[model samples]
Target: MSQSDHDCLFCAIVTGERRGHIVSADDAAVAFLDSRPLFKGHVLVVPVRHVETLTDLPHTRVGSFFGRVQDITSAVERGLQAAGTFVAMNNRVSQSVPHLHVHVVPRQRKDGLRGFFWPRTSYGSDAEADDYAARVRDAL
Candidate 1:
């Protein structure tokens, strides 16, 4: 997308027009803790310029966008002490927000996440969410 969508939630967060548990940001992408996380330290990485879906992302931005996703995946694992991570993206159908974003969830063996059936949990409080955001941000 050439410009930010005024009504897009991710765009609002990316532009600092809305509050988000922001973890990291740069020219190419932004990373933040998912309000409803599959696990603590779950992060959503999105292109700085709002693109509704992966197919809409410019070919030139694909590598850098995903490189940031890769970095967030590692950060989630290191910061949360997860065994690994569940990294995924959905197109228009299951996409919660219209903007393109990749979910990088901290995972451990037997954490009970199965397939696409994600069971979400909250940070319980703003301070808790801030703590999680801080840990990942420090790792980044």
Candidate 2:
């Protein structure tokens, strides 16, 4: 792909061409809040380099990318006081952004955030959504 390409949403975010609620950033990668979150405090971490999927990235970069994910997960847990966290990556079938990225989802005991195998329901209302955001922000 051309260096100027912005078709990839993660590339846009990394280059500041698209707006994102960024949580953390560095020379190599960035972490941002997921707009369509499965739960509160959900974050998406991506490398600055534009790679279509995990296998597309260099093996060395993969280690660093996941290292950043771990850091983000720790921050999310401390920031949200989350009971636990679930981290995952998608390749061809599950990939949404068509860029290598990892999802760090915060889970709570009563929130019914089971593993990835479990289905998720949408927030009941705007108020509920706001409440969830506030709770996670408070922890942050």
Candidate 3:
């Protein structure tokens, strides 16, 4: 553990310094029920290490970390008998906690939550869309 780990809420949960309704855990990651859920059975999957953001996570650890997330996605859907699920991650913006975590939210038709967390918008024109795509591709 590092200095940052001691300050991270999720790290405390992983190390048993704090309480979390843990659903799953292994060498790679730990998963738990969200205290404030979008719906019942919503789960948060996080790496065991104190990674602050997805971009900060090592490439070598990515597959193993997300593998745990994938397994929990299945378990949450099956265990809750949900129609489906909404999985998401906020890297830094809108991320209440700094530690990297994936949200697995159970979903059903007409379950109140709609579209997503924000309103939809369009690029206005094909040229505008192409410009945005080109910028992203260039960055890649």
Candidate 4:
């Protein structure tokens, strides 16, 4: 960890210092639901270690991290029964959070969502929210 992780919210979540509703995890990476989702099944895949941006991640960890992200994207599509997924990561500009996180949002044909024109909404309840997480976890 670096001095930045000490103040990073995602680092706290990864380190168990803060609560993140995790969907799936391995030694190298973790996946969790985005609190403010573009869609109901939107997920955020992140590396276990703190890194400011994609370029900040160690070269050796790239495959492990992105591989987990790919798996999570598949799970998002399969678990939510969506036609596909919108898998993306922000560098520094629009990255709301400091830690690197890939967005794997569920999508269907004509779902009315547009590119980068995000329309956010909340999950109905804790149980409902957790079930979304569980679905992706099971799909993994």
Winning model by TM-score: 3
Report backbone clashes per prediction: 0, 2, 0, 0
Backbone clashes in model 4, listed as residue pairs: none
Give the clashing pairs for model 1: none
Ranking by lDDT: 3, 1, 4, 2
TM-score of 1: 0.80
Local distance difference test, per candidate? 0.90, 0.86, 0.93, 0.88
lDDT tens digits, residue span 20-96, model 2: 99999996689999999998789999988888877788887877877888899999999999978888888988787
Which window of 10 residues has the lowest lDDT sum in candidate 3?
Answer: 1-10
Instruction: List runs of model 4 lying over 4 Å from the truth.
Output: 118-140
Estimate the TM-score for candidate 3.
Answer: 0.97
Q: Please tell me which predicted candidate would have the highest lDDT against the true structure.
A: 3
- For all predicted structures, in order, the TM-scores are 0.80, 0.78, 0.97, 0.79
Model 2 segments more than 4 A misplaced? 1-4, 118-140
Clashing pairs in 2: 79-139, 79-140
Per-residue lDDT of 1-140 in model 4, one digit per residue for the tens? Answer: 68757888888778788888899988999888889998998998899988889989999999999999989888888888999988888899999999999999999999987876568889999999999999999997
Number of the candidate with higher TM-score, 1 or 3: 3
RMSD over all Cα atoms, model 1: 15.1
Stretches off by above 4 angstroms in model 1 are 1-4, 118-140
RMSD, each candidate, Å?
15.1, 13.9, 0.8, 15.0
Q: Please write out the lDDT profile of model 3 over residues 1-140, one tens digit for every residue.
A: 79867789999999999999999999999999999998989999999989889999999999999999899999888988888899999989999999999999999889998867898899999999999999999999
